[model samples]
Target: MNSLIRYQVEDGLALITLARPPVNALGQTLRAAVLDACQRAASDASVRAIILHGDGKLFSAGADISEFGSAASFAAPSLPDLLSRLTQLDKPLIAALSGLALGGGLELALACGYRIGEPSLRLGLPEISLGLLPGAGGTQRLPRLIGVAPALDMMISGLPIDANRALELGLLDRLAASADTLVEAARAFALDLLGDLAPARPQTPFAEPAASVAEDFFQQYRQTHEPRWKNRLAPRLVLAAVEAACVLPLQAGLERELALFKQAEDSAQSAALRHLFFAEREAGRIPGIAEDIALRPVARVAVIGAGTMGGGIAMNFANAGIPVVVLEQKSEALERGLANVRRNYESSVSRGKLNAEQLEQRMQLLVGTLDYADIADADLVIEAVFEKLEIKQQVFRTLDEVCKPGAILASNTSSLDVDAIAAVTRRPQDVIGLHFFSPANVMRLLEVVRARETAPDVLATTLRLAKRIGKVAVVSGVCFGFIGNRMLEPYNREAHRLVLEGATPARVDGVLTDLGLNMGALTMTDLAGIDVNFLVRDSNRSAFADDASYYRVGDALYSLGRYGQKTGRGFYLYEGRQRRDDDEVVALAERLASELQVERRLIGDAEIHDRCLFMLINEGIQLLDEGIALRAGDIDLVWTNGYGFPAWVGGPLHYAEQLGLDKVLDGIHRYRDSLGTYGQRWFQPAPLLERLVAAGKTRIEKI
Candidate 1:
């Protein structure tokens, strides 16, 4: 491996460059060498000022994720040790940040007396996403420098802010034209800091209220907000750190922050969250993919439908500056879809994410047509028709007749045999799937389904396009809902089964909500239209009234005309569009339970969360066993990005590790005993699960 740190002193300034390619992730050797360099700079008599910078694509992509779950000591002075040394040195310290300065990178920048960055630099402290708080001086120094409110917002949300925004907020002292020139600007800035009036650490106490920012900000915000935190770990833990900084001295505050950080890093919640993060990136890979598969650039795209999903898919292409030709079945639906597109653009303009001119530019990029002839010039054609296989076949047949040679044909099918859809055309190699979640324009996930006949280049082009549209492309093997919804079937099945086993819809929903899913499976069904899942389920003999042990509570709700938020009703009733708990629904569940002669027990909240989640983990293992998913990490990504699994929990596999596989298998067996034979297949442990159970392994990748 290449060395990460190098130090040089000249012209009264010392420069320390983190030279790790890609990102200077704090791996074993880098950690030790960087700390050694920091010490050398501190001891050098000729060094008047210090500058820390990174080489290659980014400042750093935080800690080397590969080093996670290991007990390797930092092998260098701790962040606190280095930071405290920086402050005491007679020389000023300047941090030159470029690209992304995230996690430990942000913490490192906070320790410096000054920060300068390129206009494109993206800065963030995203420990919250990993189930930890900043363990370095960030918790103590950031609030004091930037005020508590903004710091709390940045810390809690973990969203990266662009450099211009950082400059406005005083997170950066100046901006450069490009990332490569940042070091030159930092050298100049450091020279300016070489005087009696050089920049000094702020002496203000953390509690000194900025008339505009104070404790009341959080107090007031929480009052009007429903307790929406998925769990008490991240949000509450972060708030406590911020408060400690407000009152304690810097040394004590840092100590307090470190203690909290340790607690979280070792916590099951943090482990789960970390697993989810790795799982998402893992989703991008496919087994047996040739490294030579070349991605063709997609400058123009065409869509064959104009429903909500179609319109949204069109928006993705147009918004990314790819010209679009939307082909609908009729002029009226085309007109309606085009009108909705305009409304969406105007709404975004109103919200200031776009300007009037930009909206016009995006609209200019989009075109609507009623004829298949318009698609001949497109680089790609996506079929976003209804979920019926016949409809997709007809669209593919039309595209086969009309599209230019080598044009990639794709389907936005959530669940259906994509290979069968590809078979409708002579050029099956050009066809693939890009399964966007509901409200396609808003969700950050895209399931890139790969059929066996699909050309690698076509799959590669689709993956690149997915990233361009701001979606995480998790490559998936063909199955119902591919990886995400396929695993979700068993999960949703169990939730419905619980209702008949004595739990109510409310109880099940609450348990999931508490566990950190965006909503309970039942409520999510309501939002997605209670009938939508049936479209997925009705395929492949898994539909309701089947002898399979599958359960779908929403099926009954839909049969009763409760079609979710759009119909103003679902598993729960709604007042107008607002969801309200329904006593009638609860009473109906009771009636069904009575007819089944089932016993209702006082199930604890933790048990409900674990049981529902473990079912998915079991299926994830099976998917891996069947090679529907390449790895455990791929399944994790599917759950994290598409299924609203909490990011900090790391994903289902990581969460299972924290719970211990033996414990999870034990629970599955317990549930099997009560749920019966169908439960045996649905809840049975995978071979890997069995191995982990036998070995008593608490986490994967530790060995």
Candidate 2:
């Protein structure tokens, strides 16, 4: 027997265990071993039945993702071929599942005659997330087993269902009463099947389609999901593959699934999604931080300030079941902050996302106070106070004086220098930037800024804590605005400049929305508050080039007290959450153009898309060359998670690579030549981009 496979026979049952430690990822070598084991069990007269299980924890996570796009992935017996052979076995085959059975793992389970799982089982075909449908008979076999609608939901959403839900959906034959008894239960179940002389049951036979599934069911699913699925190829192809199962025979359906899988695999959208799948995992690994580094225990957390950002930051800890103390300067502010947290929880309860008991339990974990001494024992202190540098430094000094030894000191400054804040602390090694986005509790991204003197353990601990709080944390070197916001400066500059040169706010935003961003740049500014953004720009005024027309319209709006959604006016007028274009804003832009001697002309959607996105991409390359971002993918993660960059086009850097580095370079030169001084100053191509283009390299990570 192969070392990767543990084969044994007991009581006339051949037990085949996949012994790949960690996730039992199905690779070529493991696939070959599994095939040999199954063939051996089928031929042996003494083995009346066979049971397949993984060595530990999980049945399998899926195929070896690292082997994807490599020649090894297609080496026979491929997953589809091996599964096809499994269905032909004369003896009954049973899959005993535990933990996760995802993608190819669940597809393997579906090929078995019967599947019995532990109560901890989680099953799904999540290939759609990587921009590809399941290639190994999943699309065809699943719909036949579970019917069309449920199978479509499972494949398209790429979300896992628990053991109870799987059992209820008829995806599992039976679940073991407890996780510890899974193997024993499977053995007994196999014995019972052998005693009854049961024939091998395959999922090839299809019953009549579900009554709810109409002839136009797939079309309706597409129409309803098109907005979310726009620019995404895999989800639409998944729908096609599932529809094939309903009309075609088993063999024909499997062939159609394979064809669709190959098509999706070759698409740029899938390639981008696959790149991101690896990038998100790679973002966690720091060069100097070893995997075994001891992490600080964060039993209690403290937040300074009682404003919206502070309250939201506190809720994150409370929701994660950690005790949190929120400090405010006055009694009234502290009460209001605590009340806001309650309202947020109450809103969750209303949405059926949290129960009444959960709401009270989370709220109970939050304690509001007015004294810094009250948070002296906190393991982690995050100051979400005012954005001023002096204010943050003062808060850090107080935290350094009061907090216990080994406590982490974090600042929630979006664009300020983390090193400057750390310089005020006695324990600079403990100081780090935990820049959470607005509505901190709701945003998925967390930028972890590491100062020059930051210890490896401190960085590692913050990354671990970020995961615990359900945030996609990306480590960034210290710089003004860090990763996300620093790149945003150039992107926003072009949007503001485009409006001055002729584009309206609505048109500028519409072009971006059409390109698949969550919203347009102008709309995002309005949502973030024009006055707030103007203030941020003013604080960083030294960084901007000497241009008279730079964001002048925004400055004008701020002067007019047009503060956006909160005030119902800014770049556009707001009616509640809905917004409409304002002719006055356009008039203001034209007036600025005339006073600043800037020529306003017809701006097409193409220029609007290219100028904003390409500048963003250029700034990202500059960040990469400057070492503010460790890898190109880290920059991509920051944009996709934090700034609403579409995943289908990948992040800006990856999208640039897809569009060809040479073309991006050419676009920069073209803008520089046409826009004269303004373009020459801002559109200068980064050295890294120029070098990559000269070298004819398509991948940004080559450096």
Candidate 3:
């Protein structure tokens, strides 16, 4: 018996157990062992049937993603070949599933003659998430077991279905009464099959669609889903593979699916998506913090200030079933803040995201307060007051006096120095920054800013708490704007500069939106309120280049009280949620250009795209070089999740790699030479970028 596989035969039944701990990922070694065990069972005269089960929690999560793009993935007896051999076995083959059976693991179960699962089973074909379709007979076999619609939904959505739903869809032959008896139930099922007490339920080539597929279903599916998956390759290919199963035979469909899978696997989109797949996991790793570090308990959280951000922050803990206290200086502000939280929860209930009971339950977890003493006992307290430095310092000093020892004090500051804020608190080791994006309860990204004296346990606890609250957390060293906003400075500068250089606000935004950003720069600023951005810029004015033209358009807009959507005008005129181009904003930009003695010139889309994105990429490289970001991948996670940077292109650094480091350097150099002093100051390539290109390297790894 192979070490990865355990084989045993008893009472005319051969049992094959996948012995890999954790998720039993179907790697090359495990595939070969499984094939060997099946061959032995076929040759043994005493074995009348065979049952396959995973030794622990999950049957398998999927193919071993670590082996992707490596020789081990394509070694002899690949997943497809092993599954094919299992289908050809003469004896009854049963798959006993518990926990998760995803991607190739589910494909393995589909290849078996019978599948018996525990009620806890979560089955899915989620290869599409990695920018690849299911290659190991999943696309071909899934539609045969269920119909075309449900199979396509499962593959495209990359979500798992519970065992009860799987049984309803005919994906499972039977579910065990309980998890503990899953294998025993599978053994009983195999004996029934061997003794001819139950009908043989062969699934591979013999399975048929549970219902007839509509002739126009494929076309309608494309029409409905194509817009959502624009610029994405894997989802389109998955639709084709599922459609092929409806018309073609199983063998032909399998071949077609493999071809599509290989095509998607080789594409740049898949490569980028795979980069993020690993990057999200890699972002949690802190170099100095050991994996075994004890974590601080965050049982009760407190948020100071009953403003928009504070209310949103409090909701995060409330939704996570943690008790939270909202502190405000005035009772009216506290009432308004709690009312906003209730309205947000009510909106969710109306949208069917929560039931009435869940809404009330979450609201019950939140407590309104007017006293700092009331929040002194909280395990964690986050200050979301005004963004001024002195104001934050005062709050920290007060917290230091009233808060219990070892209680964490976190700031929701976006660009302000966290180390300076920590200086106010005597327990600097307990102080950190948790920069939550606006509408914090809704956004997915959370920047866990580690201060200079931040203890390892606090950092670990915050990372864990971020997961508990359903946020994608990335650690960053203390710096202005940390990771996401720090890089956004240059990108936004270019957008504002481009508008001043005779590119209309619409034109500049349109170029970036066409490149796959969720929204244009100006549009995002407008939504976030231009006045807010203007204040942020003014607060960090000392960091700007010594030029009057920098962000002049935004400053002008703020001066005129045209505060984005709230004021009905800023970069664009807004009527409700719809925005229209305003001639006054364009005229204002032209006036600023004339006043600054800068010549106006038409900017093409290509220049606009290259300048904005390359500068963003350049700043990311600088962040990596300065050790503000731990790795190149961490920057990718910050941009993709926090900002509207397209996930399909990966993060800016990953996009730079795909665009070629040499080309990125050349673009920066071209602008630096062409734009005189301004370009010379801002467009000079980062030392790391220059080094990578000089070394003839195409990939951007950590400096």
Candidate 4:
């Protein structure tokens, strides 16, 4: 018997326990063991039924993702073959699910005659997020149990449902009181089904939906979601598999689903999405910290300044069940900030995202305060005050006087120097940058800026805390804009220069959107507030003054008080919230072109895409070489999570690898020669990029 699977037969019942530690991911070894267990169960004369249960916290987290695209995944006793063997067993089989039974785990359960789940179990087929569908009979078996529409929605959304919902959907045969009792409950459930029928014959026959209704549903789903998926083929392939299940016999549908799965698995989209999946997990790892490093407990959190950023930051702790004290200088500002938080929660309730009770519970965790003394006991104090050095210094100095000795001090600064901010406080080790993007609670990315004097424990605790709040935390050495915004500087600068060189705002934005970006640089600038970018540029004037045309369009917009969506005019005019092309803005761009002595000329979409994207990719190469980012994967995670970089593109670094370093370097040189001094200044290839090309390296990992 394999150690991963413990099998025993007693009282006419065979028990097969998946004893793998952590998540019992369905790997080749585990699959082989499972198949052997089924064969042994079938041979035992005393065994009337079999129960399958995992020994650890979860049944499984699904397929061992590391095995994907590897030879091991296709080895003997593969998941599909093992599941087929289980289906062919003479004895009845019951799947005892607990914690998480997702993807392949869920598929395994579907293959069983019965499924008994813990009440708190999380169940789903979430392979869609990784740009693949549940390949192992999920497409065929799921719709056979649940209705076609619900099954399609579940797989399409790639979200997990609780045990109660799973039971309601006819996915679970029974629900156990708790995970601890799930195995016993499965045995009890199996007793009722003993000697019922042969294992090859399923209890519930596959039901085909009406052709008209099924066709309508599939067509509607495709028409509505195909555009959003952009260039990706996984979603469309998933839809095709589910459609096959509705029309074909079980065996035929399974074969068709297998074909589609193989197609999706081989696509570049799947590979890139898989890269990001691993990158997100890898971002949490730090260089010096041990896995067992003690983390500081953050039970109470204090957020200074109840503005938009502060209020959002407070919600993160409040949602995590930590008490938060939101401090503001004035009562009116405090009330206003609290009101916005309430409205945000209320909006979520209206959207069916949060229950009223949950909203109340989270709001109760928040305490509005005007006194520093009120937050003296906070375990963590974060200042989301005005983005000025002196303003932040004063807040930290006050915190130094009031906060307890061991409290963590974090600044939510996007571009400011963490070392400079740490100088104001006595405890520099505790003063780290917890840079949360705007609408902090909603954004998944959190750059945990490690300062020069930051303690290892501080970083360890912050990384742990970020996970608690459902964030993807990537560590960075402190610098202007850290990682995401630092690279974004050149990317945005090129967008502005493109407009001045005669590309319309609509054309520039259209080019990027066609390249699979969520929005164009000009569109994002308008949404982020044009005046905000102007201020960021204004503060860094000394560093950027050598280039006269640096954000000339932004300076002109700021001078005209055209502050984007807020002011209803920036790069484009706005009606309510929708943007419209403004002739005035276009005329302004032409004026800047004349002032800069650059002839206004037509630019192709390919050039627009390459110039902007390649510039961003080059900067990421520079950051990796400077050690500002720990790894190339870290840069990928930062851009994909923090900025709106498309996950399918893998991120600037990974995308550069796909485009080839030699091609990127050649394009940069061409731009430098064509545009003279300005292009020479901005488009000089990073040393790392040149070296990677010289060495004939193709991947970002090689660099």
Clashes of each: 8, 0, 0, 0
User: Which sections of candidate 2 miss by over 4 Å?
Assistant: 202-206, 210-212, 701-703
- The lowest-lDDT stretch of 10 consecutive residues in candidate 1 is 203-212
Top candidate on TM-score is 4
Q: List, residue by residue over 348-432, the lDDT tens digit for candidate 3.
A: 9999889999999999999999999999899999999999999999999999999999999999999899999999889999999
In the predicted model 1, the residue pairs found to clash are: 272-649, 272-650, 273-648, 273-649, 273-650, 275-650, 276-650, 276-651
The true-versus-predicted C-alpha distance at residue 19 of model 2, in Å, is: 1.3
| Number of the predicted model whose lDDT against the real structure is largest | 2
Structural RMSD, model 1: 3.5
Worst 10 contiguous positions by lDDT, candidate 2: 203-212
**What's model 4's lDDT at 544?**
77
Measured over all alpha carbons after superposition, the RMSD of each candidate to the real structure, in angstroms, is 3.5, 1.8, 2.1, 1.4
Q: Order of all candidates by lDDT, from best down to worst?
A: 2, 3, 4, 1
Which ranges in model 4 have alpha carbons more than 4 Å from their true place?
195-201, 210-215, 701-703
Model 4: per-residue Cα lDDT over 1-703, one tens digit each: 8999999877788999998778999999898888889888889888888888888778877898888888887688878777877777767888999999999999999888788899889998999888999899898888888878888888888999999999988898799988787777887778767645545335563476434254577777888889888977778888999899888998899889988888888888888999999988888878778989988889899999899999999999998999999999999999999999999999999999999999999999999999999999999999999988889999999999999989999999998999999989899999999999988979999999999999999999999999999999999998888999899899999999989999999999999888788889999999999889988877788777889785898899999999899998989989987889999988999988898897789999988988899899988888888888998999999988888888888888888878788999999999998988888888889898898888888876535
Relative to the true structure, candidate 2 has a C-alpha RMSD (angstroms) of 1.8
When sorted by TM-score, best at the front, the candidate numbers are 4, 2, 3, 1
TM-score result, candidate 1 = 0.89
List lDDT for all candidates, in order: 0.78, 0.90, 0.89, 0.88
Full-model lDDT, candidate 4: 0.88
Lowest summed-lDDT stretch of 10 residues in model 4?
A: 205-214
